[model samples]
Target: MNTKQLIEEAVSLPLEERAIVVDSLLRSLNQPESEIDKQWANEAKRRLSELRSGHIEAIPGNDVFSKVWDRFEK
Candidate 1:
């Protein structure tokens, strides 16, 4: 089928199915890079290890956002 016909068929799908179709199309256009994913995983693991070992302290998300907004308003 042509593009117009394909779109009409997609539009007739149920809401959940339409969402899946949109997600699949988006993933096809923007494929993930395994190297970047691996780096992020390693960084997350390092941060968790530091927090667990008391080498770093976690800040409350609310406090962090409040500080950011305060600075932004200034």
Candidate 2:
């Protein structure tokens, strides 16, 4: 549908449904990737490289969470 008709239909939705529709519509718009995503992608590449080169360390999940909680609860 054309923009005006589409907007009219969106406005005619019930209040809550209209809000959901608007939020979904806005979120469907293109967004640029964040810098953290780029950094994570690079780090993943480095890790894969290290794994291929047989250089790796295994850390338990409990240890990771303990460290995270220590800093988080501080």
Tens-digit lDDT string for candidate 1 (1-74): 99999999999999999999999999899998999999999999999999999999999999999999999999
Model 2: per-residue lDDT, tens digit, 1-74?
99999989989989999999978877689564789789999999999998788898767999999999999998
lDDT of 2 at 25: 78
- After TM-score superposition, what is the CA distance of residue 72 in candidate 1 from its true location, in Å? 0.8
Output the number of the lDDT-best candidate.
1
Note the residue pairs that clash in candidate 1.
Answer: none
> In model 1, which runs have C-alpha deviations exceeding 4 angstroms?
1-29
Which portions of model 2 show Cα errors greater than 4 Å? 30-74
